[model samples]
Target: MYQFNFNFEEFLAEYWQKKPTIIKGGFKNFVDPISPDELAGLAMEDEVDSRYIAQHDDEWDVKHGPLTFDDVPEDHWSFIVQAANHWHEGAAQLITPFRQLPNWLMDDLMISYSTPGGGVGPHIDQYDVFITQGSGKRHWRVGPKREDYEEEFRHPALRQIKSFEPIIDDVLEPGDILYIPPGFPHDGYAIETSMSFSVGFRSPKKQELLSSFADHVIANEIGDVHYHNPDLPARQCSGAILDAERQGLENMLRSLLDHPQLMKDWMGEHLSNNRHELDLIAAEPQWENSEVREFLTQPEVLKRLNGLRAFYYPETPTVAYIHGERFTLPSECEQVIPLLCDHEEVTGEMLGEMIEHPAVIDFLTQLINQGYWYPAE
Candidate 1:
């Protein structure tokens, strides 16, 4: 377990999305869980998403990876690997401490290793991120939220912005954490070889929501009602749509909200969908009831797959959404739903009482067989 030194409620009320702040020694005596070599190793895998960025004076270069060491130069370069938690167990463990936030909004863990003077140029992110220093030191400069700025594309794959006046500038050491809210421009350059882990939270854009909702409506064949105006009032111009006509159109779009369950279902499914490719392997020789029961008797650890999204809506209390699929839980297992959704790892002893319920056993078996959840070792 990681020991968090900051005040949770105070931080949420004061700084969450309001501004950027650095918490020194957030995890006291923090030891890095994953090494730089291991991070580089994962970046070489074809399924993993990785990027190599190098700076040569004013000219910047970026390359997508499944890259070997020979492809990356030793100096003036940085290697970034996305969804590290999905493929590395140590990186997945970092997500446990951030459960204070909503589980649905929690994104995957991204790890980056940088050589001296290596950094992604100044840029703005649309989501909240808590970046923790894993090893060595990094100098971070963060500017306030601003919409007016010049964006530069030195490399097609990299989008950077003109330098801005920084409100917070400091060097972060291992165990230190820096929280930057959405729209804040920031940059971090390593002073030496170092590793950093980022735990990010998702914030859906209005346009993205509109597109997704439109797709859902179209796929379900919803909103079939056509325009019906029984009492036609004469208009000065045929081209001009009157207030009544505009209101009717608006209401037609709003009709999708008339079914609360439909909205909840769509939101649940959308939010529970994985943002990155996952590393998964189906269980071999699926366990039978007896085998499952016997397995549950021993002390074993069950872990959720990295990058797997799982959430439950309060409106539909009995249903839990995992990887865009909904599972109905029995009343007996309803109490354990939070345990399943929030934690990355759960021990057999923790679930010992619930194992007797057939519904719970079946759900666990299905999850294991489908490769969503499995024994840690």
Candidate 2:
């Protein structure tokens, strides 16, 4: 287990989304959960999203992967694999300590391995990330938050920024963590063969939200009411939209919020949707209800599939959303909803409680059959 030492409330109040800071020895005696060779193996898989970046002098090159070990050079290159938690259990466990934040804000565990002098160029990210040094050492430089900066694209796949003055620069050893908020310019170069894990948090952009909400509205046949003004005064300027007309348009758009249930349901599904492909395999000859009950009765543990997004809304506490699907929790199972949302592993005792509730048992059986949760021996 990783040991963390920072005060959660203090960190959130003082530093989160405001600035960049380092927590030295955040995980004491931290042993890397995955090795460089293991990471390389993952990059070789076609379904995984990986990238190889190399820099020579001032010129940089990038190669999208499903790349084998032979394709990667010995040095001056970095291999990045996205959604490592989807494929690696150890990587998924890394998110346990970060549950202090809302589960809906969590993204994925991205792991990168770099050779000496290898680094992705300085760039700004729109989401918060906590980078934990896994093995070996990396030198990180983080600049202040800025919205205005010239972006440089040396290679087709790489988008970086020109040099900027750094406010935080230091060498990070294994177990060190660097928390960088959105809009900060930052860069990291491996001093040696090193592995680092980044746990990211999502912040949906306005345009993205608008686009998604529009799609939802159209798909659900919502907001179909046509505009009608019964008390219309004769307009002098027909082409120009009057203040009342503009306010009417605004009210028409804002009408979506009037249906709080629809909005809540849409937000729950949208937020719980996974951004990356999941590593899930449907159960072969799907388990029967009896078999599921038998397994639940045993001491075997139940583990949630990695990269599966699950959340419950405060407005409708009994309704849980998972991967764009909604499940109504029975009164008996409501108490355990947090366990299903926040935990990776559910113990036998928890399962025991859940199994007693027939609705919960049925739900678990359905999830297990669909491959969202599996029995862990």
- Worst window of 10 by summed lDDT in candidate 2: 347-356
* Global local distance difference test of model 2: 0.86
| Residue pairs with backbone overlap in model 1 | none
lDDT of 1 by residue, 43-81 (tens): 999999999889999889888889677856677789999
Residue 227, candidate 2: C-alpha displacement in angstroms: 1.3
Number of the predicted model whose TM-score against the real structure is largest: 2
What TM-score, computed on C-alpha atoms, does each candidate reach?
A: 0.93, 0.94
lDDT of 1 at 329: 83
Q: Candidate 2: TM-score?
A: 0.94
The alpha-carbon lDDT assigned to residue 155 of candidate 1 equals: 80
Clashes of each: 0, 0
| 1-377: candidate 2 lDDT, tens digit per residue | 66577787898999999999999988888888888778889998999999888998888988787976676567888989999989988777788889889878888889999999999989899899999998999999999877788999787777799999999999999899999999999999999999999999988888978888889899999989998899889867889989988999899988887888898888888898988989888888888777777787887888889889988865455688899888887765665667787688786587556676767777877888888988885
Report the C-alpha displacement of residue 111, candidate 2, in angstroms.
1.1
Report the C-alpha displacement of residue 170, candidate 2, in angstroms: 1.0
| lDDT score of residue 117 within candidate 1 | 87
